[model samples]
Target: MDFYLTALLQGLCFSGIALGIYISMKIFNIPDITTDGSYTLGGVVTAILLTRHLPGYVVLPAVLIAGGLSGAITGIIHTKLKINPLLAGILVMTALYSVNLTLMGRSNLPLIGTSSVFTFVQLVNNPNQNTFLILGLIVMAITLLIGYLLKTDFGIAMRATGNSESMVRSLGVNIDRMKIIGLALANALTAVSGYLITQFQGFTDINMGIGVVIIGLGSVIIAEVLIGWLNITSVWISLALVLAGAVIFQLVLAFTLNIGVDANLLKLATAVFVLLIVSLPRLLQVKD
Candidate 1:
């Protein structure tokens, strides 16, 4: 029960990255691999600030800014330099490796005895319950905010830019600017996950963000499956499903671990699981 509860908390913590991937891949149609680096950038910034005795609230904006900047660089490369989106993300992600290392000045940083967002307010005596409450509220708030934004005119243009870039460009919507902002927003959200996870786990490592994109992608794919099955069209419903996907994804992993799967083979298992999720639909279509 405790193991599943922990996985539930982790799923909530991961909501940010899941939403980020939804925006980047579903809304913008970009396979932004910058997720890996920007995520660590968030953790690095959060760790550095918290170790200096900075409050978690104060550290939040710094993480968002750092993540946004990294994403903006990738957007600029893709839009201004006319580079392929995948290549642009790769270039920025590669550069962020050095940037994260330089910012941390070390490979690993522990956050023991430091105040975190989860510790910011003690509504309940039980730590796990407190964390669950806080995370639930935060995830809901973010989902509502993003849902409202997607219904706005600016967001409509952004979505249109993704669906029909040439059409939006013909309407003088400045697709390049939209792409830049969209990617920045996506990465900023991804960074928030870094901020949450680093504090939750009590440490931040240089390699913490490695293969992180797969988790986000897997979560988003799960959401997509639900969306198709339910024929969901409302933005609110869609975003909520994404959050559910994140939780469900984590729970699945926890279940796998509980079943005595080797911890060392977890990544391989994750890859296979995600591959099955991604390929199953196509396989079904072929069968039909």
Candidate 2:
């Protein structure tokens, strides 16, 4: 039971990234691989700020801004420079590797003695429940903000731009601007996940973002499946399911571990899980 609880916390930690991917991929129809780099960027920036004894409030905004900036760059390259979105993400992601390494001045940094938001939570509550509460609140607050934003006029424009770029452009809407803003918003959310995960886990590694995009993709895919199956139409409910999907993804991984799957094969298993989720719907539709 305790082991499953830990996995639940882990899923909450990655919920922000899942939301980010949902915005960029599902809403904007763009494969922004920059998520991989931005996730680590958030962690590295947060670790350094915390190591310098900065307050959590300050540390969080810094991580968010840094993450947003990376996303904006990818957006500019794709929208302004006419580069393919995939290639632009690859370019920024490649550059961010060096940027993250430079910020950390090492391959990894441990927050052995540093104070984080989690530390405050730990001080105020049971150590065992600290992660559950802190991560849960953080993700919930962000989810509300995003859910509200997605229903606004501008937000509707962003969604329409994704669904019909030519029509959005014909309507006097700036399609490029929408894409840029959408991508920036997406990466900013992804960075939040990185920031919290670093603090929650007590360390930040340069390679922490490795395969992170896959995790986010898998979570979104899982939620999408559930959303479709349940005929959920409310944007708020849809977003919440995405967050729940992240938890479900982690729980599945934990279950596999409990069954004694080799640790190194976990990534392979994740890929297979995502593939199955993505394919099953189409197969079912065909059968119907």
Candidate 3:
């Protein structure tokens, strides 16, 4: 039971990245691969700063800003330079590899003695409350803010831009700006998630972000499947479902581990799971 709860909580800590994926893929209709790099960028920056004894609050905003900046560069390349979105994301992600390494001054950063928000929470009260409670609150706050933003006029413009860039341009909306905003915001959330995960896990590896985008997409698909994907009537519910799905997916993996499944094959399992979920709707329609 403890193991189950721990995995669920750990899954929640990374839920922000899942929400970020939802924005990029579902909301913006863009397959952003830059998340893999930006996730490490956040973790590296936060870990480096924490190692220098910087305040945890300051590190959080810095990591978020760095992620946003990296995303903005990708958006500029895609929207302004007329590059393909996928290529732009790839280029930016590749560039971020060097940047993250430079930030860490090596291939990894360890937070052996540093104080993080989670540590502070542990100090303030029940040292036994678990790091997940703090992470859960942060995730809830981010989910609420994103949900509220998606309901506003600007959010409508963002959705319109995603649905039809040419139409948004014809209506005199700055399509480039909207794209930049959406990508930046999406990656900022991803970076924050990365920072939290590094703190929670006590280390950051440069290679830790590899395949992160795939996992995030898998989480979104799993959530949509579990929720029936029919009444995606509001952004809040969508975000909530994504988080829930990620936790459930982790639980499944934990169960597999318990059954002596080889961890080396987890990526294959994740891919198959995503494929199944993504195809379910069309398959059901055909059956009907």
User: Over the stretch 96-214, how does candidate 1's per-residue lDDT look in tens digits?
Assistant: 99999998889989997788888888989999999999888878888888888899999999899889998998998999899999999999999999999998998889998889999
Model 3: runs farther than 4 Å from truth?
Answer: 123-128, 226-230
User: Considering lDDT, where higher is better, how would the candidates rank from best to worst?
Assistant: 2, 1, 3
- Winner of 2 and 3 under TM-score: 2
- Per-candidate Cα lDDT values, in order, are 0.92, 0.92, 0.85
Candidate 2 wrong stretches, greater than 4 Å: 122-124
| Tens-digit per-residue lDDT, 1-288, candidate 2 | 988998998899999899999999999999999999999999999999998999877988998899999999999999999999999999999999999999899999999888878777564457758767777788889998998899999989998988999999999999888999999999999999999889888999999998899989999999999999999989999999999999999999999899999999999999999999999999999999
Worst-scoring 10-residue span by lDDT in model 2: 119-128
Candidate 1 residue pairs in backbone clash? none
Error of 1 at 12 (Å): 0.9
- Model 2 alpha-carbon miss at residue 86, Å: 0.6
Residue-level lDDT tens digits of model 3 in 158-242: 8888899889889999988988988999899889878988987899999989988876887888877766756676667778899
